[model samples]
Target chain A: MATLEIHDLHVSVEAENGPREILKGVDLTVKQGETHAIMGPNGSGKSTLAYSLAGHPKYTITGGTVTLDGEDVLAMSVDERARAGVFLAMQYPVEVPGVSVSNFLRTSATAIRGEAPKLRTWVKEVKGAMERLNMDPAFAERNVNEGFSGGEKKRHEILQLELLKPKIAILDETDSGLDVDALRQVSEGVNRVRETGEVGTLLITHYTRILRYIKPDFVHVFSGGRIVESGGAELADKLESEGYEAYQTKGGVTA
Target chain B: MADNTPAGSTTDGAIQVGGPQQPIDARVSAPASYDVADFPVPHGREEEWRFTPLERLRGLHDGTAVANGGGVKVEVSAPAGVTVETVGRDDARLGRSGKPVDRVAAQAYTSFEKASVVSIPKDAVLTEPVTISVHGEGGVAFGHQVIEVGAFAEAVVVLDHTGDTTLAANVEFLVGDGAKLTVVSVQDWDATAVHAAQHTALIGRDASFKSVIVTFGGDLVRLHPRVVYGAPGGEAELYGLYFTDKGQHQEHRLFVDHDTPHCRSNVAYKGALQGKDAHAVWIGDVLIRAEAEGTDTYELNRNLVLTDGARVDSVPNLEIETGEIVGAGHASATGRFDDEQLFYLMARGIPADEARRLVVRGFFAELVQQIGIPELEERLIAKIEAELEASVA
Candidate 1:
């Protein structure tokens, strides 16, 4: 089983004025087959934590310890983190103009799996995954995320999640901009991966709407770059009814 | 000191402007004279010669460059119904497609001993392509070649250049009515070679022509491609792809003159540069004359700068003299690798270097497919990977 442990993670970004801290001191852990929802308001460093774990160069790790099953994840480069089984479904997936989805998927699979997948079987696997995600088969030939709709982008991220089969996946705001039907389809894809019982899911979102589909085992209330409160699944119900208003006040657990 | 000389001449032009802007009239259209003596030697001041280093030309711009006996070794492979002949200068078909607009072109036209003419008969559609390979052994050389396709014929020509030489040559394409012709010119010379050439295409009524120019080797190379419509309903597609390495200068200047009604043209050129002093220049010019109503044209140039010191200059100009034209537009973009694109690929487990190579390959993939030759496309892709490998090494 794989476990991702992030302790006192402090990250900063180079803003126009100077280096400003985004994640002050955040702590979280995700074990195999578990789902942890990081709920936060806008600009609460939810995406920053995701990008930092993915080793994005734009996020500077000032003071932190990120380990994947006792191995130092902070020392690994972006691709190494991926190879070591840490996947990130970005909030904004970048558009790579000339790379087809099929080629990009195969290349990514080869890089992570350490060998090229057999062509015939790999094509079958991709077709099956795409069909489950409600994607057109012709979408494989389109450029990666180029001119894709909001719902399509979310579906593509989940498609990669299923195909790559990483040990730990941090889905950052995958629920946003998706319609009701698209949200259900994408959540179904994520649920399918979770059913394998070998991957940990870090579902990050602002609203608790997605929690209705893919139930989270642990709920963490994040504010000002740190987890202010942690509880069982009932906390999502509380956040759904009361919102983050209780966490916004200084040291208020009044709710 | 000449009384009729324009204001932008040599030192005066360089000192007065002191910038990248060119004088209005100095932007060369078609010149009136094709004689070698008619065009004056450039001092790196004119718009066309501004990016070119004059001394590196080896006297090709002036009349001093001569065709030594040790020059290019030309080989030709023709299909069953094709005719290959070397005609002398007095042939009536010479210069019918275009006149020499620059000093290098005029010098090449006046210096060549004889011109190689490859002709395809009317209504002949060959299954096999015509291949011409020009290998430079040594010394300086000048050449002139014309590939003529008769009415209703369809042909593809591959002109491959290899080895080292200081060469200046002119190539022409005459596509007859209802004919389709595709020409792929590859400049794969030795790293020390210098090459200058001008390509002209004359498109007949309802005819179609496509030119694919690929440049990789050579220390300095400059190519000028111009298209003129002989009748209405002509269509032309000019696609170019080049890889510029350290200390190499590769320039492509194109002009598509829409002088006939109902004619259309499209130009797209993509390039990648790596290492210090690697320079790539693209100049796209499209002019629609007053009488040419119903004209449609668009040009695009995209450059990917792979290293710090590599530079790219992209200029796209569209001149429309008719308000009745259908459409005219152009775009030019030069940039480094998109970091977000790299990060996205890497986050999916592709290594940094592999991710970079993929991005560059994708940048040129569209133009490579426009070539319409699968084997050459694969070879060009391999060449691109090899070039990227050297950069990392």
Candidate 2:
């Protein structure tokens, strides 16, 4: 079964002066068939944790061991880790002008699976996936993220998540730039993947709107580079009622 | 410094032309003045050929462009419903209505068949592109061609330059007003071929013309595509790509002129160079005239040098008078594979080589997609894949 394990991970980015730590000693684990949510205020290292896990060049890992089913995750290349079942739904999917969504999806699929899928089966699967997410088939032929509205880019990333069938998916603010309709469509896409029992979801965001659709089994309050508090899904509900102002004041400086 | 001296005459009364041969007596040649015979060799005497390289013409007849093993041959089979007219240099059909400039008095092989003119009638919309195939398997052959698209007509032309032998070809195009013409030229010559080609285009008012050249073959290939608008509302776009490897020299020189008011033109060319002696050159010149008010023009030339041995030279120029009657600008830059863009792709699950390929592919993929033709784009990708395979070999 697929599993994600992040242990004492410290992340930092290059600042004007020098390296400024963003994620400090953050630790979390989510086994297959479970969805976990990470919520925090701005600069609380939520997105940093997600990007570091995805192997973005900008974020450097100070110290940590990210494992997938006991495999050394940090040691794998970004694509290798992806092959090993890690997927990241980026906050801002880059607008690649000429690469169509269909081409990108097919390439990504071939990349993750190590070969091209049978045309009939793959076409059917892609069509079904789009229909389930309330996405039009025409969306597949459009250029990847080019000329796409904010919500469209986010949904497109989810479409990739559905097609690649990754075991572990880190949704980095999937709900940040979506209208109500787009938010529901994105959440539904995440839920459909969970329903298949083939993927695990790591929802990273500050909003509680998406949690209403893809309920998280556990909610972690990320304060500094580390998770300061962890609890049941009620914690997300609590944060939805009360803001992150107090959490930022409590241990934010140390973060 | 004699006031009585003619424009090109030296005090010796002999015209000293700065070309391959030494000064020729202007008096003996002036009155009769340049029969096509006078242009046995191309020198830098004429304005159009001022910046041209005379060294390239050193092997005119003596240094034959040897054909690849078994020899090379050229054949032109255009799509049906598209009429093809073959004209020989002696046919007098390829001559311009205006004064003839004996720049590179081209010699299209009789076996090479002077040139062919393809015509797409007015208002005729062609679904398939006209495929012109050139085969060079024997010795060397050079070709000259002229194409005309009638007003309100739409057509695509595919010029496939393939040679098992060496070849140098020149192509020229003229599009009538309000016609839409798309020209996709592919150069997949044998690596043994040394290719030097020139293409000129004149776009009439409201005419939409696009020229795309995919360079991959030949020991060395130099292509120049020039476009000048006839009047306001005319449009022209030039897109080019070249992938060169060691022992191969590929260069592209492009000129887009907004000669009339309200004309628009855009040009973008990207290339990748690899191997120990691979070289790529790009010169983009956009000239806007003072009277060409309210014209819009932009140009960009980008190059990618994949390895240490590869080299790229890029130059983007913009010439505009003090009058700012329109929007005009130009940009040019050469970059190796960006470590960050690569890392980003790799992080998303693409391997290093594949990542570089994808980014490089993505680098030019944008332009290929923007091209109105799809099959030619596939042909381009396939040609690049051949380069990849050869490099690996």
Which has the greatest lDDT?
1
* Residue B68's lDDT in candidate 2: 31
lDDT of 2 by residue, B16-65 (tens): 11231321112111222113343444455542343334454435323334
Q: Per-residue lDDT of A197-229 in model 1, one digit per residue for the tens? A: 999999999999999999999999888888999
TM-scores, all candidates, are 0.85, 0.64
Listed per candidate, the RMSD to the true structure in angstroms reads 6.9, 11.2
Candidate 1 error regions (>4 Å): A12-25, A41-44, A62-64, A118-121, A237-255, B1-26, B43-45, B62-71, B77-93, B120-128, B150-154, B177-180, B262-264, B293-298, B305-310, B321-336
Top candidate on TM-score is: 1
Model 2 clash number: 16
Question: Model-by-model lDDT, in order?
Answer: 0.88, 0.72
Candidate 1 chain B: 10-residue stretch with minimal lDDT: B9-18
Candidate 1 lDDT at B255 equals 86
